[model samples]
Target chain A: MKLTILGCYSATPRTLNNTTSQVLEINNHMFLIDCGEGTQVQLRKHKIKFNRIKHIFISHLHGDHFFGLVGLISTFRLLTREADLHIYGPKGIKEVVTLQMKLADSWTNYKLIFHELTSENSELIFEDDLVEVHTIPLNHRVYTNGFLFKEKEGDRKLDINAVEAANINIAYYTKLKQGFNVKNNDGVLIDNKKVTTPANKPKSYAFCSDTMYKEDIVPIIKNVDVLYHESTFLEKHAHLGPKTKHSTAKEAAKIARLANTGTLLLGHYSTRYDGLKAFKEEAQEVFNNVELSEDGKTFEFN
Target chain B: MKLTILGCYSATPRTLNNTTSQVLEINNHMFLIDCGEGTQVQLRKHKIKFNRIKHIFISHLHGDHFFGLVGLISTFRLLTREADLHIYGPKGIKEVVTLQMKLADSWTNYKLIFHELTSENSELIFEDDLVEVHTIPLNHRVYTNGFLFKEKEGDRKLDINAVEAANINIAYYTKLKQGFNVKNNDGVLIDNKKVTTPANKPKSYAFCSDTMYKEDIVPIIKNVDVLYHESTFLEKHAHLGPKTKHSTAKEAAKIARLANTGTLLLGHYSTRYDGLKAFKEEAQEVFNNVELSEDGKTFEFN
Candidate 1:
């Protein structure tokens, strides 16, 4: 899985910075998450194949998180997209987008589907053969849900010596790799694990933004390959953090530590600060594998 | 009056260009006209006082014309704006904006007033002492209205020399400037016109965008100072002009000539064209004074 940070600044889009938006490429699916204002332009600058983004996951209704959605949808129509586009966001998203379409009188030629998320519990929103998406309920100013993209686990390993001894037929190789024992013409069983090698391990990515520091999500995202949580402020403003329901760098690190995720990606810095190194230093105090998510930056799970 | 063109391009906001948006500053009132996406960033780039923009006029509901409105409203609230903000647009605009606010659960502290326009006839939508705003009924794919910002005939010019010749007392001079004749103590009637040379002729700016070349509006914008009309395509594609409910440069200039306006400002160019000189050239074919609107450019109506 690969992740690209399209924009990650707190508050509103400024002359020099953008709001929240990111792209996650998992199992060949380019999923856009949290589109803010100017996100379409960012998509163009990043050279991401926007047409490939069939699904969009919006965490909440914060302007910074999803203000750019309407523009992006309009642009897609203008670009003459033919593929069915799916949007999974908080409730009322359908009204906002459909109203704009109704006002413009420029509806799309392709199917425009809206999956308004009103559920408070974790549920599957999208799934394919290789990947599955689940909502991670979060505590925020509005009904919010973080997303978890997990790759389906593959078959177990095989033993080459056992396969040769059992004289497993080449036609049953696939079945053996799928962990199914095959019976040869000699009436001998060839154990699946003894004939096939294990498939590549699956990876997971969890995204949480504009939410308070909630540990209830730890179990859902525990041991995930990559966990990106918003760090809107620093510990110095910890008191203000609670008032705004935003987390500090230290607070994000605490959650990452609790979840024991492979890596922690922190972003969504407040516009008040010019530099973001302080956040890195603060988060590093608790989690060693914490990385800062910069605009236009990309990360790949190893 | 000062005018700033934040995004003068037609259609969608591209990677390198934006859509329609402008700011007409009249009598210290910052009036935002047509907010396209990335308009807030442009507002910041031009150092515009976002808080001072109490009134926003949207020509229509096309994404290119008003997609940025919600973001702007959200930004204003995030900035803690206390002043009441007024939005004037087609009917159903209030529903679109307020619903987003409701979903975000971030209502503004400032009073947000919406003036939904549905009239097909010309009428005054906004009026103050120094400036008056009138709707210029437009023909488009959707119900649209053009806005005309005419500087109320300059607060009756003093005409000091004329006042002195008429022996009009300073106190009565105020009455003369108000277009009223006053009788002096000697029972002499001081003609208001004789005391105050016709106050500086009001300079009116008519904005007609996304409209067909309809000459019926000539009488409405007759003899205005400046006219900003949409010239989406050059005469080369003039065949599609009327069908699409759009105007060509030549057509726009024809309106300016028939209206006998002082200047014709051509904008909303189609992205298909690489240059704007053709638009100006086409307009000049009908009217002598024609200018092209460029993004980030300003036209000071001194």
Candidate 2:
């Protein structure tokens, strides 16, 4: 799995910093999250293929989070895209986007599908053979959600020497890989565990942003391989977190500690902060495995 | 009058080129014209004071022409701007902008006034003591209008020596500046022309964009100090100009020549072209006084 931070700063875009947006490549799919203004330029600057973004997930309707979506969609149409694009966001997203297209009198030649998410409970939003995505309800000034992406476990690996020693026929090899014992050519039952081993463990990633520090999400994101949470403020401005429905670096670290995620990635720093090093320093006090996200930064997870 | 080209390219904004947007400074008023995507960043890059832009004129509802407007307005709110902003555009602009703000639950503290234009004929849209802004109707796929900004004639220069030689009273100096012949203290008429020369010929600037080659606007923008017209393509792609309702550089030059504009500024070049030199070269074939606009380029008119 690979993750690229196109923009991580919060509120408004600046000459040197951008608002919220990122690209995640997992299970052969590229997912765009929270396309803030100027996301397309950032994508081009980072050399990310525009058509590779098949699915877009928006956290909220805030301009800093989703204002770039319409422009990106329009650019895709101007490029004469043929692939189907899916957008998953809150209920009002479809109306807002379609209205703009209607006014401009320009419609996408490709299939534009909207999956409006209204459920507050944790529910599966997207699933395929390789991956599954679920929503984590978040607390914010507006309707918002965090998405969790998990890769499905693959079939067990086959041990060629063990299978040949067991005299397992080619037809029974399929069953063995499925972790099932099958009858061999001599009518003797063969042990599947002796011939095959378990596949590699699946990895999962959770993205949360623009939400206050809430412990309830811990259960939903527990034990994820990587967790990205917004740290809009530092400990010095911890008092403003609750009022603004945003999280402090210390609060995000506490959530990371409670969820026990393998790695904690912090992003969406408010522009009021001078530098990002303070966020990492504050988060590290509570969570040892903490990393800071910067524009154009990339991370690879194995 | 001063004109600054924030972004002059057409279709889509790229890392190297931006879409249509400019700032015209006339009579102490900074008027923003056609704010395309990424305009705020462009403004920052150009170091334009945010508060200086009090009026925004959008030619049409196309994404490339006005997508950056909402983001700019939202940024103003974030900055706690107290000055009222006036936006002049097509009829649907207010609904489009207000809807986004409603969805985000973010309302501006400053008053945002919208002047929706629906007329197909040239009409005065804005006017104050120092300046008058009139819409120059244009032919395009969508309802569009080009703006003509005229600096109202200023008070005639006080020719202090001439006024003293005429023995005009201090109280009558104001009458001389207002182009009125006043009675001297000795009861003799003093000619105003002898005391003050005519004010610098009121400079006018016309902005025409996203329109096909149409001659009807000639009378409206005639004799303007500078004319900024969209030339999305060169003469080589003249066939595409009519179909797209855009003008070729040669066609823009034709308009400039017919309107007898002081200087013709060609902009909104299509990204397909290799460089901008071709646009100027093509336009200069028909018009002698021609200028090519680049991002951050400025033109001063006296």
Candidate 3:
């Protein structure tokens, strides 16, 4: 799995800083998250194929989170894209996007599927054969939801020499990989585990942003391979976190520690801070593994 | 009058190329024209003060023309702006913008006044003491209007020597400047023209974009000091101009020549061309004075 950070700044977009937007590539699917203003330009700058994005997940209705959505959809139409696009966001997203299209009288030729979320509980939002996505309800000034992407377990690996020694037929190889017992060339039943090993552990990634320090979310995101939590402020500005419903670096670290994620990625920094080193330093004090997210940076997980 | 081209390229915004958006500074007022996506970032890059922009003029409801408007307004709210902002655009502009605000649940603290236009003919839309703005109807695939910004004639120049020699009262100077005959201290009525000359011929500027070669607009924008017309295609791609409802460089120059504009500024170039020299060459063939607009370029009209 590879994740690219298109933008990571909080509040308004500046010349050098952009608002929240990221591209997560998992299980051969590219998912766009939180398309802030200027996101399409950032995508172009990053050289990400526009057509690779088939699903878009928005955290909230805030301008900084989803303002670039309509522009991107319009651009797709201008490019004459034929692929179906799915958008998962807050309840009001469909109305806002369709209204803009209606006003401009420029409707997209492709199918635009909107999955408006109103559920306050953790529920499965999207699922396929290889991966499944669930919503992590977040506490913010408005109705917001973070997404959790998890790869499903794959087929078991075949012990070729052991299978050959067992006189397993080529046709039975498929059944062995599926962890099922099959008859060998001698018409005798053979145990699947004797010739096949279990599949590699599935990897998971959780993305949470624009939320206050909520301890209840730890169980929902427990033991994920990677956890990206918003660190909009430093420890010095801890007082403003609750007031603004944002999380400080220390608060994000606490959540990361409780969730026991393999890697804790920090992002959505407030532009008021001069450098990002302080956030990493503050987060490291609590969590053993911490990484800072910068615009245009990419992270890979195996 | 000063005009700054933030982004002048046609169609979707790319890495180095931007969509249509510019800033026109006339008579001490900073008027923003056609805020395409990423305009707020462009404004910040150009170091233009955000609060100085009290008025925004949108040519049409196309995504490239006004996609950045909602984000800019939301940024104003985040900045705690209290000034009134006036937007003049097509009739459906209000519905589109207001619906986005409703979805985000983020309303601006400042007053947002909308002036919807539905007229197919040229009409006056905005007027102040120093400047007046009118709509210049153009032919396009959508209901589009170009903007005509003209500086209102100022008070006649004060000839201090002539006024003192005529024994005119200082209080009557206001009346003389207003082209009214004023009585002097000797009780003799003085002719206004004898003491004051006409205000330096009111400078005018016309901006037309995303329109085909339409000759009817010549009368409305005739004799303007500077005319910025859309040149979305060059002569080589002239066949695409009529089909796309866009003007070519040669076609733009034809309109400029017919209108007798002092300087024809060509912009909104299609990204297919590698360089703008071809556009200037083609335009100068028809009109003597033609200037190509580039992103971040500024033009000062004196």
Which 10-residue span in candidate 3 chain B carries the lowest summed lDDT?
A: B97-106
TM-score quality measure for candidate 1:
0.92
Which runs of model 2 end up more than 4 angstroms from their true locations? Answer: A164-167, A170-173, A183-188
Candidates, ranked, lDDT: 3, 2, 1
Model 3 off-target regions past 4 Å?
A: A186-190, B165-167, B181-197
- Clashes in model 1: which pairs? A157-A198, A158-A196, A159-A194
Candidate 1, residues B1-302, lDDT tens digits: the string is 77888988887887778899999887778899999999999999999998889999999999899989999999998889999999999998999998888888889989999999999999999998888999999999999999988877664667788777766677786677778888866769977766566666666788898899898888899998899999999989999887889999999999999999888999998999988999999899899998889988999876
Model 2 TM-score, 2 decimals? 0.98
DockQ for model 2 equals: 0.82
Residue A162 of model 1 has an lDDT of: 69
What is the TM-score ranking, best to worst?
A: 2, 3, 1
Candidate 3 at residue A158, lDDT?
Answer: 98
For residues A1-302, could you state the per-residue lDDT of candidate 1 as single tens digits? 89999999988998878899999998889999999999999999899987999999999999999999999999888889999999999889998889889988989888989999999899999988889999999888789999999999876665767677788777876688788888976987765665677888999999988888898999989999899999999888888876888899988999999999899999989989879999999999999999999999999996
Better candidate by DockQ, 1 or 2? 2
Model 2 per-residue lDDT tens digits across residues B204-247: 99999989999999999999889999999988899998899999
Best by TM-score: 2
Backbone clashes for every candidate come to 3, 0, 0
